[model samples]
Target: MKDWNEKCAVVGIYNAYNASILSYYSLFSMQHRGQEASGISSSNGEKISTYKNSGLVTKVFDENTLKKLQGNSSIGHNRYSTAGEDSIDDCQPIFAKYSLGELAIVHNGNLTNAKKVRKNLIEDGAIFQSHLDTENLIHLIAKSHKHQLVDRITDAINQIEGAYALIFLSRTKMFAVRDKYGLRPLSLGKITNPDGSVGYIVASETCAFDLIGAEYVRDVEPGEMLVFEGAYSKHITMPKSIKIFAANPKPCIFEYVYFARPDSKVFGRNVYEIRKKMGIELAKEHKIKADMVIPVPDSGVAAAIGYSRESGIPFELGIIRNHYVGRTFIEPTQSARELKVKLKLNPIAEIIEGKEIIIIDDSIVRGTTSKQIIKILRQAGAKKIHLFISSPPTISPCYYGVDTPDKSQLICANHSIEEVRDFIGADSLAFLSLQGLKNSIQNAGEEKFCQACFDENYIEDLQE
Candidate 1:
């Protein structure tokens, strides 16, 4: 992606009291997914209430706001800029009131045909209040002739071209749907309360399941719609007859390598284990004589551990990251991003002053951040810094939910491996092979996840 930020998480809860608290907890667990904004929409049998703002979850909501959102069924969202610029109006759980009642929707992933859809909707007299793709979905569903909400949703989804894992809140029932290719991760789980009532949760990742004391039931099947009716649940899988643009199912490979939390499982694969194996394979590709292996903080920690274990090199926390930095993309300018990264990360001079270090990271998007990081290590008196990427170079842009820039925007696409190494000022640099990446996720089931960003083998026609 052209230095674009990642999108947020969509969470929905059903048949539970203190739904606002559950929303708070779910959004908090997914804070890493998006830090730009947080929102919640709840229904208390009679009316729907919503509160959303452009800020971190902690800063956006308080006890009074939670108390005000009294409802038994609710949906929450954490946002990173995707279709819209970073503004409070773009914060989600976007609600639209129409003749058929009110609907609130939270979405994760991007809609490839959103611009076209928006123009069509506008021509048909539908006014837009925000730049989110979810609003387009709401309008599509509202305009569909189908009466059943699931049928209308299916109809609307057939027109959308990219990835989406959505949670829709109607007057009574809550619905969750995943894209046909299953590009984004969504799962269903349930929690049992002591008051003889049950609660159902839908989140972007399984880690959210653990936080809410919910047991994961199953992943939302591709091209499936799930409806929870407070006491009963129903599922509908779109018929295979539906003509979907079939590109190779290139789920964002970055999710396995970096974006997902280590503890979470994506597409039946454990992220931590997959990342560790990537490191092992990376070590095999480029053997380096390093005194110690150091990860570039949080995202690289799992791979660094794996590299150390495989190469028999000691692992050290040579760099520390400040957790307080908000989303880097939200900064108004490039200079701000540079300054934030410097402030957020500092090298340990004592640990790397005279050491030959191997720095492991997930991927290098634009190479700007990596360059600065390497500069920091060099200034810290490191003898040598060899950089290893856990995944293959991202040459093509992502057309799925991920907000990747045009192919020309990818630094690696414009520069050779040696050029990138020189630009980053690393002694040596290597990326995990495509085969190595697939091998790393051996436990992730025989069917491949999406590797289109690295390998231009898409299962579906993206240009359509």
Candidate 2:
């Protein structure tokens, strides 16, 4: 199946005992954001130390390993390659030693202007350690002649453009910043110990806070920088001169649709509720006759329930997904996709036999997985298959962090609705209208969202 992978997950903790262990728990909860590499860096009030490797969090760190990263302040990352080649050297939080001091950074979004910035930096005789965009950020911070650490970070970010939720750790303090557009999600959390001491957490999602018994604070504002010293944290505003996009903040709508866990609260709305509303809206937009409403499993479950409720169709587990499908599967191809469908999901012959099925899915990126799944259902005796996508058709490739297929490769970008239906071998196919999608997220707070994938409305300035 063609899966949509986000760039990474980041966690920062300040004034916490066993900061590395708490950071480990936070990263474990957000392992879904990235799977290629994981790392953590800690500051013990005297020196900054780091431990990182290319693997899952569980595989990268153990009990003794966390103990070695002793400190009351730490930052961590889980990475999926977007800006650079996947290798041990590219793993984060990338650490550096400079004239100012020791610093470590964990970043969660792609900088649209990184290449231009890197080129200019190289022209000035700056050396780069890795191809990762985060490495470029480290370089930017190092070059800034600003005396204060926060001022240097401010200077670095002023020159770059794109979506980012960044966490920076120094020998004495911790810092976090979200891009002006807020295209990615980041939240602040608080954990109170029995002894009345308070600890702070910053992560890519609130689910990370839930696992560690931390209380969810509010989201880090777009264009806002947060500084943490011990248990005290303060907010700093980005310079108004650097603001380039429309003044309105635009978050990534794909987070609610697919990337975030259903249990998460993103952009100030519950993801599960928003997805359910999306499914309901999709059903209202397209009324179809079907014997059962079945989901693609996991991602489609909440939306499928809403669809079944709205249409009065029976909801059944027509397809069972294998939870043990690992990253070591064979490379994806036409034949491999077919084989993968068989290995990943099995049709419940008793429920699907002779019944027309309406399969609800979040979105179809390439249409290969849906096509193969329909084939499997047909082979199991499904009389007919109709596909309903909860979100609008994805027609543009995302450049602000998501690892998506190029525009030329996106099925919806290249084909019409009927063409996609035919290619997927479905009896009929319908996608949620753009307006319906907008209505579904009415409760997602005052900020607008980046719907570039649905409509070619790039929100950021991508030109060099």
Candidate 3:
């Protein structure tokens, strides 16, 4: 419900008997990453077939379509369009015929150099079909003079910059690659078939592996590529790793704060544990007096629990979210806007009436949603609302994959904390300190993460 949107999810299955089925299930598991479109492309050793549409995974693919995509290797994607127009033509698993035979590609992050490369490609007489920056890759691979697919991929990799977790599927092999900075996430896993044969899977999140019964191996390292090749039909060995670029890992910190599923392990840590720790850190940072601790439903639940545990305050689900509030309508009027939020969340007067409550949420974007939430609690007869966020106030725009508005639109970027507190109608408002966020991570190694959204430090150029 907040403004930040995940860019996409990519899953690749190799040497599995039901590669298409496994891909479908993995995409379904990671559907939280993207909802605008879903697609899969399968390769049966000699040929590659692709199917894509603009909708949720379940709505886009069915038994009939899955049966038609018969193959032993496949790659799939769920897209939220950070770099493309919202159209069927922009749906992913972009398949094409090229000099290196045929291949399909799925990508999970935005490319910073796409416009320059696309313009160069266009000047060289390349005709474009889709608005997706991912299409820029297809052209790069197709036009490369390298004799082999891997070499062509390396050539293309050299031409692109910024965040990307990409999966490339050919007529016989599959390749998974992560950018030098690891701005987005992608994990590698192993799947043991019923016949004792081994297959491979790589996905945007480890949660995708859980649904398909794949064993979690480890994260694909930054600037690394895994090349998968073997005979068709559920028989494959471990992938060949190639170090393409020197590692400079700066994985997005927002994955722990919002994008990832709580149960999944991202960047060598469990998201749920980190979130609970964030709540604990929040309790330590903010000294509050309240009757109860409450969550804003869904994303705020875990941190609220941690806050309650740390502060010895009772926790309550004061706000209930409608799980089936699927399709959204345009709200042109003020009344309609309130109705839209009310349709998703309504307060429980029995628990909240005349009670001083501490409400926890992930982050505030434009401040309108937070204002509406506080308004609803006021109407429910709550005595006071103390609003807290688990992460540092988002002050800058994200240039990697996360969908955020410009600095002018981010409320915290423009307004003071006191001003924001008054705007949202909260008695008090506080955000977790940047150090608190670092403490929640529980990092034991030298693992550094991208906090560009919290602190403006762009490793790449931000174009005008």
Candidate 4:
């Protein structure tokens, strides 16, 4: 299924003997976040070394590449370009040299005011090397008058607007900071070294901790900065008014809806469990008679199962996804995209022949994919097709990190529910209510979720 891709995933490790290797594994686990590029930077006491390329993490970093990035502290990034052209320079863990020393930075989330910041910096004669907003942040840090790297980062952050979960590395220290609103997520983990010493890790999601045998400690609070000096981690506070609008965090609700992996615990809740709850809620909202409930595989599996259990409809593997299918949205032309959709999923004729099927999906972005799937099911002789979405209608484009289509391109943003159902050729289409979506996820306090894509109640002032 084609869905909005998350902008990136970040991992930072300190005081570990084979920091680069661990980072490699961490990025490997979160490869779904960004498939276009992967990178890692390691600090070996006196200088920082980096290796990055456009490809999957396993394809980009082999044993030889990891060996070259030797250090006891490292930072890594997996990127799907949201703001910049996909190029060598845009692949992250972007390094820069300033008067202080060598510094490298990796970030997740978009800086909504980066265009303004870039214009101002250009007027001040700052030379930017890449088109990425990440590079804009680097320029900000490099120009700060503060002598200490942490202080410089804090100063730079105060000047920027919008969501960020950033990790910055100097030769001796590693720092992790979250945007004041916490529109994106970053987690802290603790692991034991081979020598039994403790090491610290920070990643976009807790699933990264599980793969590396680290125990999750807690989420890095919104507006908080964590400094890792050798084996110790400390909280650092900066100037007032750094917070723009939100007094507390408002993490992107879409993380639970689609972006995050089911295995991940994002924004303090298990994604799989939350997705299942959403499915249960969807089932309650829209009662339907169907022989079986099927998911648009991989992302929609959990929700489909929950719907099946709650509605007394057995779940079956009606539509199977081709594991090796390339991302269809990235295909260049209309014909290529249409062909890609057919190649990516196929319905089981035997199971679908006479059965009334209910297809459960996270959200409908453009409705093209949904239309294709319904057509395929009908061709396979499905008597009826009903589509149920786990989240409210996505009406606005997400400005934080997710690479969403423009509001004009979004089907729900323009068409009513009935119009969308007819457009996709489904007998019925139902979406979970906003209240049901909030109640489905555990600990998703009303104030903590950024539902801008659904309700357009953006936390940040988009006006310049």
List the global CA lDDT of all models: 0.82, 0.87, 0.92, 0.87
Q: For residues 183-254, write the lDDT of model 4, one tens digit per residue.
A: 899998887888777788899988899999998888888888888774423221221223323447778889
Model 3 lDDT per residue over 342-425, tens place: 999999999999999999999998999999999999999999999999999999988788788989999999999999999999
TM-score of every model?
0.92, 0.95, 0.98, 0.95
Off by over 4 Å in 2: 231-247, 329-333, 444-447
Q: Cα RMSD to native, each candidate?
A: 3.5, 3.0, 1.3, 3.0
Q: Candidate 4: deviation at residue 283, Å?
A: 0.8
Candidate 4 ranges with C-alpha deviation above 4 Å:
231-247, 327-335, 462-464
Model 2 steric clash total: 0
Q: Choose 1 or 4, whichever is better by TM-score.
A: 4
- Model 4 lDDT on a 0 to 1 scale: 0.87
lDDT (C-alpha) at residue 251 in model 2:
90
lDDT by residue for model 1 over 1-464, one digit each (tens)?
A: 12645667999988777877898898998888888889999988777899999888999999999999987789999998866777788999989876568889999988877888899999999988888878898899889898787678778888887788899888777888877778888888887766856778889988988987888888777776777774323232221222233433345667887778899977777889888999999988878898999998888889899999999999999999987765556556867766877888999999999889999988888888898888889999999989999889988776666667788878888899999999889999889898888888865456667777787776564542
